[model samples]
Target: MRLLATAAVITLSSIAVAPALAQTMPVAPSVLPDGTLLDVTATGKTTRVPDLATIRAGVVTQAATAAAALSDNANRMSAVLSALKQAGIQPRDIATANVSLQPQYRYEDNKPPVITGYQATNNVSIRFRNIAKSGAILDALVAQGANQIDGPNLSLDQPDAALDEARVDAVKRAQARAQLYAKAAGLSVSRILTIAEGGEIAGPPPPMPVYRMAAAKAADTQVMPGESDVTVTITVRFLLK
Candidate 1:
């Protein structure tokens, strides 16, 4: 009987002590001894010539009836697609951007608006891998039936290399700034706590001249893809000794 009683007391005591041990456990320190944290943000930029261009071309047609307007737009749009294919543009590179039909309105002085005619519009966005021939392709589109042309938004197909270069520059700048600040404070950089990339910023493409197809034989449009800047920002944290 005495042995059984002692065993029960021992088990109860162990259970009580387990909770106490857990409550008194040590946690890792979030900061070092007398540590000073430094945060610096630096931007790096590099320029590269764009290799790809995205062109938006479409046809706008007007007729007295909705069916007539839609039929006319379809026919014109078909010609534009055919021209793009003839220029070595694959089907995967072309996509329909927008298609809409709306009623035109004319307002008279102090009178209700009148429905003038129906207008139909169809637009497609084309990706040109060979930017050298893009200008000629645009000219061909105009010769076909494309009346409205928007842009050849120039860009790089693979920007990873350029972005990596920018990142390296950013880190170098950050380290330089951190070292300067640390020296002014009579401290040395102990270790890097963390490095976080903010993001990459791509500069806008150069403006394109808008074109209206008035004649079948329009001069070949000249496309100049200027240099574009790729920028990167990095935030670094360092622990000072």
Candidate 2:
């Protein structure tokens, strides 16, 4: 119908450049259809600020004996835990990620390896609910013997609701596209033959970029959480009459 065509065009225009994210999905029907099979695919996008951040921080110590290395690491680890608590990191937010003690070896050609010392490493995964204070917390952790800091894996604490919104948008986009193709071919959309959900970014994004300001009034680590993109794509097969 004319109204259907107009609505389809309106929907298409609302999502400018969205066509670049999708194409006609290739599909074959199991049974012969009385009408034509028109396939359409579309993507939906949404932006959200990250609500959770995860960091891996720990200490590394080396000593001539394994016992000595373990003892030193434990003492340093205690200070690190205290610092985390002082930074308002809840006990539930702190988890031991890794703890290991390995022997240091010196290797030479045509000779057996020699034991040099023992290396101890203890790392904890720290989840920060207050992202703004993470920079200051890292500084405090460093002051308390945390030598290795790995992340700030930023993510949405509750992504299910956001993902559902994207799904609705994607379905709307696909439906509009189907109408467009049917109208162009002098046919009417009769029914939806198939609905298939596509891939999505379901996990935390890569670690954020962090920096340490030295020339400023307070030399401390800075954490920046820019906007993250949540996308969903779907393919719909329409029976055109």
Task: Give me the candidate number with maximum lDDT.
Answer: 2
Q: Could you say which candidate leads in TM-score?
A: 2
Candidate 2 C-alpha lDDT tens digits along 127-233 = 99988899889988888898999988777777777667877888888887887778877988899877776556344445554676677556778788777677766
lDDT of 2: 0.76
**C-alpha lDDT values of all predictions:** 0.73, 0.76
Poorly placed runs, candidate 2 (over 4 Å): 1-30, 202-207, 212-218
Clashes of each: 0, 0
What would the C-alpha RMSD of candidate 2 be, to one decimal place?
6.8
Model 1 clash count equals 0
Per-candidate alpha-carbon RMSD to the true structure: 17.9, 6.8
Candidate 1 residue pairs that clash: none
TM-scores of all candidate predictions against the true structure: 0.79, 0.81
